[model samples]
Target: MTLATAAHAPEGGTTAPAVRIRDLTVVYKTPAGELPAVSEIDMDLPAGTITGLVGESGSGKSTLALSLLNAVQPPGRISSGTVEIDGLGDVVPLQGDKLRRVRGGQIGYVFQAAQNSLNPLKTVGKQLLDLGRSHDVDDLRALVSEAKELLGRMGLDGARVLDSYQHELSGGMRQRVGIMLALVLNAHVVVLDEPTTALDMITQANILEIIRNIHAERGLTTLVITHDIGVVAEVADQLAVMYGGRIVERGPVRSVLGEPRHPYTQGLIRAIPRLTGDIDQARALPGRPPTLGTIPERGCVFRDRCELRMSVCDTVEPVLERHADQLVACHAVAGQEPDGGAPTDDGQEQT
Candidate 1:
């Protein structure tokens, strides 16, 4: 489906958003000082749709996704903001059984290294059936049946691999099994962190197609964290662009992909490989994103790498402002296009 069609808010929809995160900040207290891995990111992940969080490594994409699952890596803690699940609201501040139920039942996560998520000692079938047994599966036979079906759907040998251990499966197969595990939860939201990163291009595409199909069929709200723009274009209805530790651009994928507002977003679009002869016309922003800890307090985080950097950028922080359908944080983009929309290359305007 087209992005515009998929980004639709329901007509008085009954479900609270699958996930609503506001001003979410994941930080750490270090010998140097307080450090922020992910800062000031706000987005509403509606049910049954995919929202792509795109950024470079160390840009805090993974940190943000992990925070949603309450699974942030070592030394990282959520310093502020709220994470509200569809049925269980305010996940961050919650503790104990309520948090457990909300996370494991309402949220399913697929990691980049699917192999790592599974147990090498157990049969794949056991791992896949674990979730189902907790909620709906009444007996061994029932859980096995569901596991088999899920495996088959992912193009794996469901019946055969059911008895096999993790060491027996290929990398791609292991990843598929990881996806199957998440599916068995019947989760309201599925968080995929570069699920296809370990595969070849063809495998990546196949996985992407499967994810899209699953989301559409189940009306599953999905949070996909990836370094690839192509992946985002294929599956995302909504986009959240990040840099350093913050969201710099967010909107319908069509606009953010077509005409980006932040320099970082513009740089990202330019970096994607083009098949339609426009590859050379694409822009590439120079330099890497700044590291999180011990960072300079003054100026925009992207100033050193921004082609449009100004003297004022060194002394001020930009706030995300609404422009038409998108939200952008940039000093250069502000007010120039008063309509709050991106400028078309050919002098055309869209609102």
Candidate 2:
């Protein structure tokens, strides 16, 4: 289905959002001081749909996703914010057994690297059974049946896959099995971190198809975190654009991709290579993303590289405000477009 069509909210037309996050902030405590990874973000993940969170490295996309699982480790901590799951109360403050119960049971997570998640020395069956045992499924036959069933959903031979070790399977197969593991606990929400990274084009397509099918058939809410715009274009119903530890733009995938309001969002869309368009016309966003420690204390984070920047951008930070259909955080886009001529050959507008 098309993005616009798939993104139309309402499975039964009465279900509340699956997840709600408000004023969320994650900080990493360092010797120098505190550095914010995710800063005061507000977002809603609708039930039974895929939401794509897109940004470059260090943009806090993965950190934000992990926070949902209370998986942020070490120096990284959820300093502030409330993450409310549908039936469960605020998950932000959950600790020990409560937190452990929620993770891998209520909300499943597929990490970026499948091999790293698996034990090299153990057979996949042992690991799968271990997870089952944690959740109190002691029957070996039942656990094996469940493992085979989940693998079958992904079109894999469950028995064969269970007998093999991590090194025995291909990268794509391992990734699919990772996803299956997340579902083994019958979690309501699934979070996939760069699920398609490091896969061949054909493999990527197959994985995406599996994700889409699971979402449709199981009615599970999904959050896909990735830097690939192409993956979002193919799988996401809603899209959120992040920059410098904040969500700069958010709306339906069709609306955001087709008529992006924020300049950063626009640049990301333009950077995608189109088969029918002029190859050389594609341009990368100038300037590197800001480091977490180096993020400016005030003003718009993207002001330095933004072609539409005005004097106001130097002094005033932009809050996410409603534009036409999407919410965008940009002082320049909040009012008038900074008067400059159309884009030039060099990818910058003429003053």
Which candidate has the top score in TM-score?
A: 2
TM-score of 1: 0.88
| lDDT leader | 2
**Model 1: lowest-lDDT 10 consecutive positions:** 342-351
TM-score of each: 0.88, 0.91
Q: Candidate 2: deviation at residue 199, Å?
A: 0.3
Q: Please give, for residues 1-351, the per-residue lDDT of candidate 1 as tens digits.
A: 123433464433225246878888898777776798887777777666689999999888999998898777667889888887867777887777666665657788887954487787888777656655555556768667776887888787789988899888877777777777777667768899988887888888888888987777667788999988889999898899988888888888888888888888988887876778877776566776788763457778888888788888889887777665677888888757766644443222121
Compared with the true structure, model 2 gives a TM-score of: 0.91
Model 1 spans with C-alpha error above 4 angstroms: 1-17, 129-137, 276-283, 341-351
Stretches of candidate 2 off by over 4 Å are 1-17, 113-115, 138-140, 337-351
Please report how far candidate 1 places residue 206 from its true position, in Å. Answer: 0.9
RMSD of 2: 6.6
Clashes of 1: 4
